[model samples]
Target: MKTTILPLAALGIALAVPGHAAAKSGDVQFKLLGTLVAPDGKITSVKKDLIGLPAGTQTKADDNVVPTVAIEYFLTDAISVETIAGVTQHDVDGRGALAGAGLVSNAKIVPATLTLKYHFGKDGGIQPYVGAGPSYYIFIDEKPGATAVALGATRQKMNDKVGAALQAGIDVPINDKGLALSVDVKRYFLRTTAHWYAGPTEVLTTRHKLDPWVISAGAAFRF
Candidate 1:
């Protein structure tokens, strides 16, 4: 799990940034990135298992690639704030004792995040940055997989949760026209509960680790 703390840390960064903010002050940068979402959906505990799950059952979420957009505003040449928008989908399958079992299907996630970054170098050169902030994972349109359906699971739900994120990346300038190539990676620490229901009755409940790595690379436009 990421110990990056919470979103409130963004409030304290102004006092820590170096005094060289005049060059890129008030600048805005827009980026269109191709992102990869890789998550670990391993079951941590089975709170309720009415369906008689076998011993040592585990789960793993699949990876996904999607298009994402990032918008950033520079408070100074060295410090900036950013947010991203995108949707990712995944599927969880059984492992260990539950090998070959399908657990969840087409789970969509909206990783709502905000970060405060500190760029390392001055303008007209390659710059590296590190950031941290809060994250809210919104789950949507999740359905039970074939194995669960066969075992009498009529519906499924994954709860929304608040978490933290840590990020590190770099930006390389292409020219003097505010064009750049950027690469970024973020790791989010999150946990949530999964519930399975049969018509009007709740049948099972489990806790899962949802730590995900988000990697992105693409063109950036700064003005």
Candidate 2:
């Protein structure tokens, strides 16, 4: 009886040791990813005083795919902090009454997000996570298109934005060396003001709500 108990106790410890040593504190992970930015929200004009425009004008942004990168530092086996950086360019066009008028404007958006993540499961398997935090958006290189130029608009601008972000992802281990494949999705709740100019005059100002959802898949290396 005593000999049988000793072997069973050793087997239990062996099974637990590998998982405990796999992911611990002070581990760093880096991921190189491809992200698809899809705009699932509407852009409504606060002021529609321009000619041939109706009240409550709205528009939609086009979808785009871009390269992204993320770095995560594990505080524990189950908790981590992650930072993500990416740049996406979007073409804004008229929806509803503004459809088929070509592009209204094009703008480049760079979002830097910091999140606190909670990871589930033990080692040697899939690690699923959920995260939430804040994001800072930098809007640059805005250009007015044919539709805006025809309306006597010379310049277009989008204000920089700061908003909340929510994220979820899963990581599948590829080997024992801490290399993994990651699939992630994140959403940004953002709103900003769009400024249209004719020479030195600010002709149109409207509130633009751009809640963009990002889906990403890539590889991660843990060290």
Candidate 3:
């Protein structure tokens, strides 16, 4: 009878294991995925006078669309860290109305960001998150036409920018492995000191303000 009772007790313990696992499913996990960032923002600039000409003018930096790839890691049930990188290309219209001379130029800016995020969800429902952080920008490949009266149009190299970021998003789960679809929006506030070398007799510098808003939709996986 003792031998019979031992086998029955073992079967009962085996059946209880699934219940224990279900209770512990709350353990932490990591997530990895590819995301796309579409940025929409306005550019404004401050100009200074040159050669006794009334310079010191501040104008819009130019408008453009930039694309990027993002990565994020979740540290706990409600916290995460993320990074995004991409390049931006835009055109300066030489203050069209200010310069009836018809001048236009192009500039390229690349932005990279790091953020801390907080997530919300209960019982595996839809999770929404928000993030705030800092961004670093690099300006390159600037070309301004000779007719550009804004000073150092072609001679300017606005290589660096520093700013802050604000973001919000939601994720919809698809399975137990933590596969989900995500949608997010972000805003970056930044500025740059634009400098140009115009021939041997001219060098110009200006301060620019750039604020870009980005919206992204993509798929994510958790491990």
Candidate 4:
């Protein structure tokens, strides 16, 4: 009987706390962010390789910086949903036994993502959040590298794929108004199939892991 009463009393006190729901429901936030995209474009397996590949051949994708925007809406004081818009470009280059070889050049991707976030803290103070959600990676305008073209490959294609992202971030209030400083980080897990064709014949095919770390910092406005 005492334990039950103690628990109920604690809940009542917590609910009565001041500024508990400082970020009210139906609030909207807009952020303009500078984002860094760093991907692991390593070869996971060779499905088909007509063009001979050296033993222990590996690959890496170079990083890029891009401008991004995020829109968020609060469902409750502690829960919100957010989506981001951005396009980034990357280049996959050979490593290990096939060093200095370019495999795919100027591969652009639209990382479409939506997340449901749970936030902690009041509106006039620091709020930290964690989120997770599904993602789709759209590949565009990827060209066969110079080496691939020289090696009888004239075209390259990377298949679009479904993926997931885990996110964590913090929003720090700048003033009494609805302005904040925001920093966010997300880890994406995804894979894609690469195809290289020589004219009409498919010459090379491989599977690659494109797990990328995305970091962002920007100013946020809420109303």
Highest-scoring model, lDDT: 4
**By TM-score, is 2 or 3 better?**
2
Task: Assess every candidate by TM-score.
Answer: 0.89, 0.87, 0.68, 0.89
**Runs off by more than 4 Å, candidate 2:** 1-21, 48-52
lDDT of candidate 2 over 1-223, digit per residue (tens): 9999999878655544243235678999999999999974366556645544664457778899999999999998789999988889987887777775544456898998999999986565567899999999898898877888887888888899899899999987776778788999999899888778889887777777788889999999889
lDDT of each: 0.88, 0.82, 0.60, 0.91
Itemize residue pairs with steric clashes in candidate 3: 43-61, 44-61, 47-56, 48-56, 49-55, 49-56, 155-196, 155-197, 156-196
- Report the C-alpha lDDT of model 1 over 1-223, residue by residue, as the tens digit: 2346544355344223333222388999999999999999999999997888888899999999999999999997788999999999999899999887888999999999999999886444467899999999999999999999999999999999999999999887766677778999999999999999999888999999989999999998888
lDDT of 4 by residue, 1-223 (tens): 9999999878655534344235779999999999999999999999998878999999999999999999999999899999999999998999999888888999999999999999986444578999999999999999998888889888999999999999999987766567778999999999999999999999889999999999999999888
On residues 9-67, what C-alpha lDDT tens digit does candidate 3 reach at each position? Answer: 78655433221211122333333333333333222543643533234333454455544
Error of 1 at 219 (Å): 0.8
Lowest lDDT 10-mer window, candidate 2?
12-21
